[model samples]
Target: MAETLATYEVPEHHVKMYTANVQAALNKEGGILTPLVSSNAYTGEKSQVVNFIGEVEFVERSTPYGDTKVTELEHTQVWISGREYDCAVFIDRLDTLKMIYDPTNPYVERFREAAARKMDEIIMSKFFADRKVGKDGTSTSAFGSANTVVHGNTGLTVAKLRSLRKLIKKRHVKVRTVRPKIAVTAEDVDNLLGEVAVTSADYAAIKPLVDGEVSSFMGFDFIPYEDNGGTSGDGKSIPSFQDSGSVVRQLPVWVPDGMHFGQWDGLTIKISDRADKNHIKQIHGTFTAGATRLEEGKVFQVQSKNAA
Candidate 1:
């Protein structure tokens, strides 16, 4: 005897449940860098312009009541345009009937994971890319080369961390105020573990080898992030590159304020039956967002060999 077929209809409550699930998943796994950067929501705007005021020199008073020295404040801006990202999946009515369980949950997980990775990719791309500056945001400013720590044909080590810290400190960025963070891959963490100073109990209180991760060292929070050689809109892997016959991973060390994420629309989901396509259920998720480097001094890159 054949199994009795019954009509399936998506409940309104089910749609709300799925939407909440997607939003929660995105917030939880939407990349390590997204939560660490400056994020803002916008309405009716294609792009966001962040204004920066340059440092002003304080003139010492030479006379008791001398004329005030007239000075102009330097103004620059960084423009971040929103980009749309989405994922869709369809489930045939027959497929749903044959399956023992609903497949929508698995598809939702995949979408959230991919979207999370994409968010990180956007941030990593902007770390070293040129920024749109000037009052009208028409001019372009290259990332300061002086801020980069050369690979030196080696993987990440304490020496590089110290050098990176020194460079940031030279810019007068206080650790408490700036809250510096460094994005590193598993290979980079392994290299650090191999070093005596990092793993050895004598040098540090926290043994990275025992913990199986580098939580924090040298006043910088170490965040494990895999680049996967992903490219941005400009078709460049700003996070890693080939140099000196070696694949160099461009790890970014930055303060939260140095990078920005503008969200035109937060993660949203829609599920409905496609009437024209034999009533197949469609799961669609999308978000409009963009990222940009806010300041050159607040962001720095550490280039290290990607090696075993």
Candidate 2:
């Protein structure tokens, strides 16, 4: 049998333009974990699992005068897998021509903003799902559960932040620096303000509380979510510090290298014409990516009680 070709031909120049536009938009989306972990790439559509090797501890032994004891380095593996993300923008023939002619087109900017938001959301959701939760234990030894779980649901405050840092230290989570990542919903912003009175004499230095510039607090790289309550396609809101039935879960704290994001090599923009006689042009942005928890021990969940 003969192959049926596409009805309309997409010009080389148009395809190039699509590629440039999509790439520029993707570059504008800055995600939290994108810089913290090492990135990897794969070739195929199926999920690719990579092994993460853990550190080995060496022991000191006393030997005979002329004899020596020898030992080999040992390590453990944590497996991680990633998938692809794809999105398409459809434009009518007239609209496409307008975009080509108008350098300051609002349409292009709107499209770029939407694409950037989606890119960030995908990475954040993956980060939330690929972590370990902590429990209400006095120390790290008595905390932790499976399925990307962490403990602590009490609201955010300076003292609670210190407790989280102490828990992280107790776990001996080796970190390159003193900073840990902490995310909070906009609603929690008010909770934090209540802890520090805005009318006090110290409010001058604590103005981030009033102006909303509190990027770091209590040794955490504070990440405030403008909208943490919206639901995804699966009917679940973007995972933030929230309550689960009787147990309330607090935010996450971690070392930079504890997680990783892997991307496929040939991430690009694809352009084509519609098969239907509508004369619509399709611009697609596609890339393959996966995230995994490299060292569960390096990440901690802070379990908190409901503020009464």
Candidate 3:
């Protein structure tokens, strides 16, 4: 049978667009990933604001007069479970128009272009674009409509898909995520905010960045939900994702290079104190992969140059 472009079926480009955009948006970024740094890169920056506080409630309260204040208690504090993404934007974008669209009667093409633009707006603004966006905001390469998938298109202007393929296939820098996680004792959290503080605190810390240099380490924190005295699958209420620390904070990160992918035999990270050794205190750091709940193959691996 002669092969054809299938938007929703075999190599469906349409389905791929939505899935790719959605996963990349949620998994990594929050909005339009753009290249404020690179002119137009395969990867871009993403900004996300994690919740600083979880659910809270008013405790049993009692009012007392000035004389009775000494005899009556006022109220107490309590904390609820769960985590919050709060508000964050992930930015992602293509460097140039990969697909071709007719400009004369460019309604659909215009919409695709518009989507790209709106994505840029949302990312830059660090705001969530209501989920009312349509295909009009998306665009396809010269191959065909963004609604179409099946990367194999031979009927169009470019009979030689090989040439177009070469254009998009190149090794470039990657915009990856930095989710910092650490193991802590319940006592550690109490030490951070003090005993009277009962509410949960979710935090995000983006380190100070200098132009041209890689970013300083960042830290993120979340409340760990627990059940039946456990906290893994059932979302057991374990230690909070981000805890407060008095002395040296324990913020660990697994920096996945946005540019490299393949049979990665191993990964390594180097650390040196950025602050004045006398003022900020010199510190050393190490790296290691934590236990992941994801099953192998469930992870999405972007293809790297010459990576089979």
Highest lDDT model number: 1
Ranking by TM-score: 1, 2, 3
**2 or 3, which is superior by TM-score?**
2
lDDT tens digits, residue span 151-217, model 3: 1211111221223222223221121333322222233333332321343331111111111112222
User: What is the Cα-based lDDT of residue 31 in candidate 1?
Assistant: 71
lDDT scores in order: 0.74, 0.53, 0.22
Model 3: per-residue Cα lDDT at residue 40: 16
Each model's total of backbone clashes: 0, 17, 31
Question: What are the per-residue Cα lDDT tens digits for candidate 1 across 204-277?
Answer: 53355245454777788887765465453331244666775678877888999888888886777777667777
Q: What is every candidate's alpha-carbon RMSD to the true fold?
A: 4.3, 7.2, 29.1
C-alpha positional error of residue 101 in candidate 3 after TM-score superposition, expressed in Å: 17
Error of 3 at 37 (Å): 26
TM-score of predicted model 2?
0.71
lDDT winner, 1 or 2: 1
